[model samples]
Target chain A: MTTTTAAPPGGRAARAAAPSARATGPSTSGRRRLAPWGFLAPAIVLFVLFLALPIGYALYLSFRTEKVSGLGLGSGSRTEVWAGLSNYAAALGDPEFLASVGRVALYGVIVVPTMLGLALLFALLLDSRRARARTFSRTSIFLPYAVPAVISSLLWGFLYLPGVSPFYDLFERFGWDVPSLFDGDLVMFAVANIAVWGGTGFNMIVIYTALKSVPSELYEAAELDGASQVAVALRIKIPIVTPSIIMTAVFSMIATLQVFAEPTTLRPLSNAISTTWTPLMKVYRDAFTRGDLYSAAATSVIIALATFVLSFGFLRLVQSRAFASEK
Target chain B: MRLTTGTRIAALAAATALLASACSGGGDDAGSDDGGSAAGPVELTFWTWTPNMEKVVDLWNSEHPDITVTVNKQDGGDPAITKLLTAIKAGSGAPDIMQAEYQKIPQLVSSDALADLAGSLGDDVAGQFTDGVWDAVTLGSDAVYAVPQDSGPMQFYYRADIFEKLGIDVPTTWDEYADAARKVHEADPKAYLGTFSANDAGWFSGITQQAGASWYGIDGDAWSVDIDSEATTKVAEYWGGLVEEGVIDNKPMYTPEWNAGLNDGTQVGWLSAIWAPGVLAGNAADTAGKWEMAPMPQWDADAPATGAWGGSATAVTSQSEHPEQAAEFITWLNTDPEAVQALVDETGIYPADVPASTEALTDPPEFFSNQPDFYEVAAQTAQTVQPFTYGPNINVAYSAYNDEFAKATKAKTADAFVDAVDAMQQITLDDLKNQGFNVSE
Candidate 1:
């Protein structure tokens, strides 16, 4: 009796409501399958137009060069021609480009490690129960993230000026000699400080959020096993947050390589920074100041490739140790 | 699954209608004909990097009632140029007028981004500006792309009280200047005469300009590099000697030490341009009436008294929808006596127009204690400027030379600096050659 009742229209309705109906049944396939595509259509269109189109255009432009016939006096005389690998060769061979890369690499070495280390330390301290004024310190340390990079650079630029600086005044009061932070030897560090100060808090919050995600039960278990808070942090907390740390490090590396805003903003005050101070700066100079967009495009592609390689290379090198247990 | 084919077709039609309208609205706003005379007032967008440009825009707006001019203040020289170039490439959204530096004119002209003003304004407009100003804006034999706005005539500004205390008079020659710097330093071990930033090649460029040297020369279809000329060497050597002598404060500009020096009288003087007086006054406001301007110490007694450091020109873009109105606005802003005077009163920018200068000579600024007529600066600018062509590869040459200068100054060897500059000149020539410039061997 039950079989007969279920086998009627009720069974047909249940079959229609089943998850595999659209995939397996021919009756429902055409009408049901287009919904996902419709949902994704807008986003796919936007992504292609805004992101993919410009990138493809830049790639095309990177392989082109201008040819000027005769005196290049008029519009018809100058024409765009395929350059192949010449622009890339020129960018790679450029001493200025190499110097900028070296300078930025050194800058990243100083900034990334120091900034992330401080951020992690601050985050860990904030997480500690015995730490005093956790709320105040966290807010104050994170306050700089609220300031824009340009504004931060401007503030630091003024502070580096001896006349307006309290540090300079204090040095004078003590009758001690003072050196300029904008000097050739120290300008990189001065720029790095601005980047670190502006970036540390945001990274700290990211790390802290990762730490907060760790269950208190794990800590309880560690404490029960006679492990101290410091030991638990060293053995468990840091290991658990390794993914977040890796993410921040990757981002910081990219930011360091594209160090244009801080140096550009600081330029008006100090004469130490040239037009081609960074790779991105050099790209800007070629594209605009020098009016050689082909070379600029070539250089940009090279830098982007370098960033991708470095990020992945570093990730791969650390991934085994960082996410081994998680996997 | 059981729906009729007609219903599906109707749904598709409705979706197409919605998508078409959305796409059309987006395209319409982005691609509207800028030249069309709409019911509303015509708006012109002007781009400038200078903070003082706001004042200039205000002056222009007050005088022109029919057209509204919108000013977009951008930062960083290179970024502004990038934005301008991108807008031009996009074939729309470009500003009607832009403030371009004199050195940048060559690159802009080469790229065909600027509108040739000479054809519209005629030879009389070119004649109205001083020769140096005119030459800086002209590319090859083509019409001028930019209208001369102001000249950055280099001068030496010193703290009068500090100089008096140290018993140092303004020097006439480089030698005398060095001697005075030494005396000032000896009198007050804590004081240095001026600051030089290693990256700022403007000082070296100004010195070269004063020495009657050109960075590039047109030789048939090719451009010749003259950055390693004897005049350039002389200027580099003189500056190198000053740096080595430890008389000039080696403090990098915009650094904390330099600002401190300005405030507390640690820096005695600085060799700057006409626009510098305003900068110095703003930065060292507490030291008002304490500073005074003097002729820049020449390399030799026979050297010219003036040279440009940095200045900009106003140019109407080729993409401007209202070229006639744009040209009119540029002419009035440049040549009108009242507009020029208002600009000077508002921003301390000396007018490039001779007639405007003549009118401005009547009113002296009280800020400088009425020491000299402010318009006298315009007169000096007119007297000392010499014609110098700005070739297409000028920016590249300038950057190479600046880096070379820094190395030489740091090395404390004039000869080494000259060698470096010559090497850089070669590199610049090579780069330009690759960029399609006809570089002279």
Candidate 2:
């Protein structure tokens, strides 16, 4: 009931870089840049409309909250009020949000490394001269990536259930005592598996494309040096694809933080996952289900900020090594 | 003022909800300012999730060409309410009328998304619904928000074949129910009598209601939350005990695994609402005729009690340009003898209109054909639905139930269940207080 903050310290969201920068060129003035500007107009308009405008509106909403008088039943009983940093503070202070962050961090730890490692391995195998039926293997591995997270979660959810799972039946037939995927701590792993299964192939394609871009002369030189295939891959292929790996890792990290659909879809099958199992889910619960857009906005901003810092900070930290390795 | 994490979030949410709704309400007034040109038959958009609802609406369209109603089927439950509220906030895209669950009525009313239909609906409409059903729409206030469509009085459904195979009788009391659960699980380790569905807050609320728990109370402008009351704790502990004892499954209901269990005979019974037959028939068609309906196991054998689960009513949105016509459509849709018969015959809902419903239901649902008097038992079950109050922040409370009970069931301890109740009470109370309500601690 107390208005915690007065000045509204941080609602602006930097507002520094306009979404569509003016087409800067050799001349600051004339119609020479007009053709290029016109060509880029569609992309600029889309970025402004879809991305920038929503971000600005969310920023504005995050600074505000409602003031309800009495029962909040009738019109005019509730009025929009300025709520400065309180929503942000509350979001950061919330244990559920913190727990979700922790869950996603753990999920990222499991998903990113395993996905990248497998992707790198597959990319190397596909890049090798001895690789056979490459198209079929590549397509088969990448097939799961085509499945949306919701559908994949549902597919994996059925496979995890004890009542209907063929795996559970198989385990029972073998008389092997396997812990349920939904049991206490295993639910996290169960969800991570879906993300990995759906993500590895895409990352593999990215690294493989980079591997294709690698000069064959380097492979011929390594072969002339009497290097084994494993030696050549580990020494040459992996190093050359490191930049692509770094880019994929950063994308995976951002995707990890923004995870919403998989755990949500799996929720019906497992009792272990809460409504706020991830930060994005909490934001969704707050905004839509609870009808409180302010908190949702603030929480999303926090997530966006976290994503920005983690991704950019990561790029900054690894830029020298990754780019140097590319040379 | 440093507050608890949940309370702080609740406070912020409460504030935004009020502000958003107030803004939308003003916009609603402005958007429709282009004169109510009363020329042609008023076209009303209705959002609902009942299957074959278009058929019933088609029936209305034929009879009353003046008022054309379009049925926009939604995903129903929480998602529909969320979508409606979002539309309300965005100041457009909302339908003329929406199907709202009883628990969600409070949240919708609190958001000012629903219009007051007391003046628009017919005078006799109030008499059509039972007091418990009516209390939900009105919130015990004079302002009528929605007309009752269907009622879901809780019932106990069991697989008779499984019961006979296990040599267990239908449980008549809570103690007997517990005993039967133990025996069933003992007979086959893979099977269970039922499950404690953490995902379904409505089912949990119904259980609490049967134990005589009223979660929220309103007096004047002040609100009181009692989610951790003795009645609720007792019910929670009972289920927790059974689950921890490995008699009842700790997993949720309405899940694929549960559906498979029903088909495979691992799931022996269901503590569900009257509309369960339709769901059972849809989920496990092979198990039909093997299932039978009974009154929920009693706390006291002499004094039976029950609670509503999935019933929903149609309400006119505040954004609607024609409240009168919308109200008229809903009233006829629920109360008219022909429309009520069509709803029962096509929609598979247990109609809330007391008089019209009794007349329409002559035979048992196909899933419960073995029980000659399905509606008879359902009608009797409907009478025992205890009166309970729902507050505007039931969403927060329900979300709290999902969060807290998920942890409790995972822990699989009766003590954890009690702890979960306390957590729900704390979170709900904090949310109410934080939302700037006059909540008494």
Fnat for each predicted structure, in order: 0.21, 0.47
Q: What is the lDDT of residue A48 in candidate 2?
A: 66
Docking class of 1: acceptable
Highest-scoring model, TM-score: 2
Local accuracy of candidate 1 as per-residue lDDT tens digits, A175-254: 98888776565889999999889888989999999999999999999989999889988999998999999989988887
Model 2, A71-98: lDDT tens digits are 7686666677889998999999999999
Which candidate comes out best when scored by lDDT?
2
Q: Write the per-residue lDDT of candidate 2 for residues B1-441, one digit (tens) a residue.
A: 011122223234444444454465455464354336776778888999999999999999999988999999999777889888877775876889899999988878887899999889777889988999999999999999999999999999999988988889999888999999999888888888899988899999998899899999987888889988899999999998988888999888888888899998899999999999988999999998999999999998899999878799999998888888889999999899999999999999999999999999989998888999888999999999999888889999888999999999889999999999999999888877766767765
lDDT of 1: 0.74
Interface RMSD list for the candidates:
15.1, 9.2
DockQ comparisons of all candidates to the true complex = 0.27, 0.23
